[model samples]
Target: MGMAAVIYMILSFYISNKRLRYYYRFVSLLAAYGLIMSGTRGAMIVPLGGVAMFILLNKNTRYIVGGAICLLFIYVFFAQTHILDSNRQIHRMRTAFHPEKDASYLVRKANQKRLAEYMVHKPFGEGVGLAGMEGRRFSRRFTTDIPTDSHYVNIWVQFGIVGLCLHIAILLFVIGYSAYLIMFRIQNRELKGMLIAMNCGLWGIMLSAYGNNFFWQYPTGYIVYIFQTFLVLGKSYDKELAEQTKLEPI
Candidate 1:
């Protein structure tokens, strides 16, 4: 799926004369559906959030309103049809805030706590792949099976606090730099929209990382790098545009 999205993005970039924007939108929507079908809640939100960002950033009031209504209707219909249980959604939402008291949430907290304690002494982490080994070992010791799913926690377990901090710093830098470019460098409406969409997608990954180890996992990890590379390329594009603009006669 990640590879497909990257290919779609590259195609969108190269297809300059066609309605590439629409193509990109459709591809992103398809990716979102794939994430949903995967049953991974964390990955599922990226496309929805990306669309919302696209609407918001483009100032497309009609589409924004329509998307909101559609989302609300879907939620209501799912709840009414019992395709999705309102109670579970509510419980999970509440658990996010009161994680210590929620069973699944508590397990995540416990793992985070244990990992943090271990990192305090080793600071650099046990090394990559160590977290998975530790998780398996711990599960055996406790005679219970619960695997770690958090990118932040996994990084800490694998590379220690330092690696986690470095990873977070890179994410923050990408978001901050992208915002700067959009605000100060980009003037073309179409280009601005693309940058905003890309930023929103990155934001979705950032949000999802809190709950899933997608940052370093197969397929998703490569996708994250591709997204980051896109941002870097955007920066370079913006710089060229700036230079061109400066050289143009006033």
Candidate 2:
């Protein structure tokens, strides 16, 4: 849901098709409202990181500097004034940046420590379904009752350190290649902006993976794979369009 907003917001900013900009901007605001109401700490990073990347990549130093100043002002203003004093949702959103104030964060850290100790003996982990809730459901024999709060940790437990490295490498490669396309291969402003937004969104998801399993969970995972493929293919489409423009008899 938050990812949807991030995409719409990026489109609203990048798209020169004025006919569609207003609709996308409206949708982006609505999605952003929903994201704030939901109060998912990890998901919040999607918008923050994505927007920052979008602005920075625009190559307009004034906008980038102004955006940073605006963010700082907003943060300071909200923290100083308890405007949402009675709002549970806003309070929860505020706690996201303060991990020490979050009980769930403390518990997650404890569980991670336990998992680390457990992994000391079993280098390749107890195997699939042995480190998470899956283990409790399918193989009670290997279940150690430790919670797998992070997707990266889950991969480490199920497939070992090697698997974790490979997973991270793949994500990094996608981000790096997309950046290359945006910087060198892509000439179309709209296409480049879309790819930049995708790259930022992916980076946010990767960062959030450390705190939650949203990256591999359900529809989000499906969307991630789709966006990844779309960005890669977008570069080729840009080249074809350029060649067509050249060949056209104007």
Best lDDT goes to which candidate?
2
Model 1 lDDT tens row, 167-239: 8998889877876776666765555656765676677667767877667668677767777777656767766
Q: Each model's C-alpha lDDT?
A: 0.61, 0.76
Error of 2 at 244 (Å): 2.5
TM-score of each: 0.65, 0.90
Candidate 2 residue runs with Cα over 4 Å from true position: 77-81, 141-144
Residue pairs that clash (backbone atoms under 3 angstroms), model 1:
125-160
TM-score of 2: 0.90
Q: After superposition, how far is residue 61 of candidate 2 from its true place, in Å?
A: 2.7
Q: Global CA lDDT of candidate 1, please?
A: 0.61
